[model samples]
Target: MSDPTVGQLADVVERTGRLIAGITPEQWSDPTPCSEWDVRALVAHVVGGNALFAAALSGQTVTPGDYADSADRLLAAFRAPGALEKVVTVPFGEVPAPIALHLRLADLMVHGWDLAQATGQRADYPDDVVEQALAFSRSALPLVRKQDGPFAPSEPVDLDASALDRLAAFLGRKVG
Candidate 1:
């Protein structure tokens, strides 16, 4: 399995956003695999996630205020037409580029499934990226819930299921 590039992630994000944007209003308000978040909230999470990562890639130290502002901006952008063109280049610092790319791919691939499941749409991510994500998620499980703050709860997820299922479960979502 090879790590995906930032370009690949951007492409995936665009496709995923388009898929989500096409959902009916009723579907947008429906429950998701995330349990706590509805479809709208799930979209919000994805938009907010993009903003947060954008800030990170742009070398902004993550703060609650930054997250709020960026998230608001991103939500508005998502509401507008042709707003998925934003690209964020991650700065891995001491880490290898492939590792960072793999992480971003995992993030996009998982969230794509989240949106798809919420809207009763079928989604199948690239198998190569999924495999990379599975390996990354499995290796990172010990630190998932233990990470600094603002962490999503994950209970030592296993990558025994399909890639999408494993990715969803790793991110505290149930497989539909």
Candidate 2:
């Protein structure tokens, strides 16, 4: 357990889950900074992602939003005995399970920010998350080739922008 990815995984998912649990029915229709996805769709994305990664971490096939307690289930799945060390069958290919967990940390935090922006809520993710996500995204950028891929090249940001803002910019998000 030398890597910090395990704990950060729980923190990112739990924080996003708590925020999503608080979303009112009205806010579901609001548009988010993610551009294409509305609040409800964004939530679905988070839940789906949680399910996918959780299933992988637990060495099972889990349909998205299949459980009522998606976030808690996600946390529990990763926390399961030997879950972290299990080999995950990802769509890309087989790799160490921890890499999958590490990838989720960046995805969840970004989507959490998307949810917060959509619903006019504040997420206050720790600075470490920002640091981790930025590093991950930077390293991952070279892997993305398609213009319509999941992420876009880092947009230009002012020097004063916070790390999170820079992350959003770097990930091709239009920061306001």
Candidate 3:
């Protein structure tokens, strides 16, 4: 049986890849909700993350490539036999492969929103994917924040805010 999480990860990668492909030349320098990273840097980070996760799963070093290539490598690695059952050492710490996958999914979800907000594009992420990412973020971010990790403290959002907006706010991005 295939891991359902892998499919979710692929869906996110495809959506984020589309967002990256849609970036206009002028918008490359636009500031993202990530604060320090502009559109170009943010895209680079996501691509690098894909490569990193692929390498972790495959036990082989992978140079950061273009978004589509990196995403392809990531999906291929995760689909490999026993990939999800192995433990991997990511930058933060050693974690189960499934945890790593969820981490990547949540990161891509929020970063995709950041890219969309920065470029004035619509973040048309699937509702189920957004919900899964949101659930993961809610459970994991508290520990990350305690370590003074990349995310800022969670900001307030309206109760009726969209899931994407809520996810962004939970990851410390201000939602209007």
Candidate 4:
């Protein structure tokens, strides 16, 4: 039986790829919500992250290629038999493969939003996918904040804000 998270990861990867492909030449230097990383840098970070996760899961060092290639490698690594059932040491620390999957999913989803926002595109990720990513972000936020990780402290959003908005805010991205 296939793990459902892998399917969700694939969907997020595909959506993120579309967002990357849509970036116009002029927008490559545009500032994203990530503060420090502009459009090009944000995409590079995501691609690098895919490579990192793929390497962790596959136990093989993998060089990151373009967004499509890196994303494909990540999906392949996760799809390997017993991959999700094994523990892996990602950059953050040793974690169950499933948690690592969620971490990557949430990262891609948020960065997809960032890319869309930077390029004036719509982030049309499915509601369920955003919700699942949001859930994972909520669970991981405390530890992330405590560790003084890359994410800033969670910003406040209205109670009725959209899940995407909430996710971005929770990840320390300002939501307008």
**Model 2, 1-176: lDDT tens per residue?**
23446678767767877778778999989998887889888888878888877777775677785324667677888788887677787554575777677667767777877877777788767877777778766765567535776776667888788777777787777777
Residues 24-52 of candidate 4: C-alpha lDDT, one tens digit per residue: 99999999998889998999999999999
**Could you give the C-alpha RMSD of every candidate to the true structure, in order shown?**
7.4, 2.5, 2.2, 2.3
List the global CA lDDT of all models: 0.60, 0.74, 0.87, 0.87
C-alpha RMSD of candidate 2: 2.5
lDDT of 1 by residue, 1-176 (tens): 44555556655666675667668977877887666788777777765566655444444554333323654443343333332333434432334435544555676677778778777776766666677687777775555445553336653555567767766776777554
Please give the TM-score that candidate 1 achieves against the real structure.
0.66
Alpha-carbon shift of residue 61 in model 4 (angstroms): 0.9
Off by over 4 Å in 3: 1-4
TM-score of 4: 0.95
Better of 1 and 2 by lDDT: 2
- Cα miss at 34, model 4 (Å)? 1.2
